[model samples]
Target: MTHSRKILVTGADGFIGSHLTEALVRQGHDVKAFVLYNSFNTWGWLDQCAADIRGHFEVFSGDIRDPYGVRKAMEDCDRVLHLAALIAIPYSYHSPDTYVDTNIKGTLNVLQAARDLGVSKLVHTSTSEVYGTARYVPIDEKHPLQGQSPYSASKIGADQMALSFYRSFETPVSIIRPFNTYGPRQSARAIIPTVITQIASGKESIQLGSLHPTRDFNYIEDTVRGFIAMLESSNSIGEEINIGSNYEINIGDTVSMIAELMNRSVNIVSSDDRKRPEKSEVERLWADHSKAKNLLGWEPLYSGTEGLRKGLEKTIEWFTKPENLSRYKADLYNI
Candidate 1:
């Protein structure tokens, strides 16, 4: 991947995508941002990016599900970072069809376009949710995939599709699987943001779901760096790599830590509406990132505790701002 190569980043208007787009621009790459088209003509998080960064991006608003639109965005681009998907777990339960269409079919569109365009490499985004409850600790790339929820199931289909493309058409593809990522610009549907918004909104009791499930979290920056490392590493092609801190902290402990950092002693109230179906919940996830280290030469720069602390502080600062905080409906339960 040369610094001068043209790159197309699908889902560039998203949280991690926006951060990655900014990072790519900062590194002097020519970026074409493939933002989801909407009736309001909104650019999502990319609208909040700094002007200088935005200036460097060639913004293309279209649906990833559209093959023509996807191909148009990939034209003349040397690489494609496909990140567009329907990611909400609860929503996936109610709208599984939408998840299949976006996560699975949308990925197919990107793969076909990348193959047709002869892109040098295609970095396919994946989530650790596909590993389910983790049959063993420190889940690695070879762990059996369990579709605990519709969202993860769709991602499984998409991941297999990318790999199939690589095998059948010799498409250069690298699957980048990131565990729980939280930070500024994250939606309130996520636990970290939900907790932060409730606390920042001056709620005395934090409403949440099950607290015993542990997760391996990676800060937004560290996750973005993992993507770049995978992109630059020639050995990463046709490989699946895990990007995480290799540390696990239960939700209960994470909330306590957040409360401590915010200097607030909020009561925790488990809500039935917030809980996942017993069979659908993932109980544990701890990433084994040895593959990432040995192959891509990538390691998380932030330890679990330090990363959570700094990420929470930055997230708190962002949510405390009236303009930013107002975007969230702290009083309502986000799906």
Candidate 2:
């Protein structure tokens, strides 16, 4: 919204990407959406995007892993918001090579293009998972990064790749590391959707992994706003920032809140298979988003315990709807 520029959003078809694309279009930017190409020619979550912004943005179907395609997608765009990557940690365990190919190599492709193109701004997406388990409370931008999982490891490589571009070639780049983001259109691989989908499917008891791990959950709206804030702020260039609520809640408590919002009492059955390996499990994550506030003048409206519940309420309402609920297979455990 700072000044309408030709903006290309990579991963614009995914959960947060779709919402961000719609938001940019709402702000009247000349936006191009780079979605993964599939045989069905689907645009993922963007297919169900809000009605008003439909057709306002252009779509470029291609794979992020393809450097040639990615370079072509970045052409004619002044700013690039790179959010495409492999994010599922469980699936990372099943297939680490894909994480390397998609997360690491895919990110390299973006950095190379951004550096070569001299894009006005490039905001790269990072994850709280790269911090692994917190050795201290309120993990900040300065906190040590420990890649405990294959997914996190690849992201660490990607984050460093972006930063190296900034230091080495002086590419206009900033990394926005967001904590657990949950909302409508989220896949069942995520905890909030996994629980909600199961409950919506009339399951009295739910299977879950470690419940002791705490996360600083940020609602999808706040996350999208954080992305936009970084996009508009020149001070964010060449820096890594954390976007989170700064409030921590355990998984068990989160489940209880979700159940309360849904007006149901449910039992949580422990599932070892669903859990991360003993050493790889990220025991806790609480974000210190002070850098975000200082740099971008941004903070979460849906913050703290009360805000989490409100966000959950909004999420439950969407997931309970027949049309949206039908999209997920809640009975089968999504890796």
> Quick one: best lDDT, which candidate?
2
Q: Mark the regions of model 2 whose C-alpha exceeds 4 Å error after superposition.
A: 1-4
Candidate lDDT scores, in order, read 0.92, 0.93
CA lDDT for candidate 1: 0.92
The digit string of per-residue lDDT tens for model 1 on 1-335 reads 22237989999999999999999999999899999999988889999998888677899999988889998888879988989988999999888999999999999999998888788989999999999998998999999999999999999999999999999999999999999998889989999999989999999998999999999988898999999998888999999999999999999999999999889999999999999999999999999999999998899887678867887788788888988889999999999
Segments in model 1 whose C-alpha atoms lie over 4 Å from true places: 1-4
- TM-scores of all models? 0.97, 0.98
State which candidate has the highest TM-score.
2
Q: What tens-digit string does per-residue lDDT give for candidate 2 at 210-325?
A: 89999899999999999999999999999999999999999999999999888999999989988999999999999999999999999999998889989999999999999999
Cα RMSD for predicted model 2:
1.9
- Cα lDDT over the full model 2: 0.93
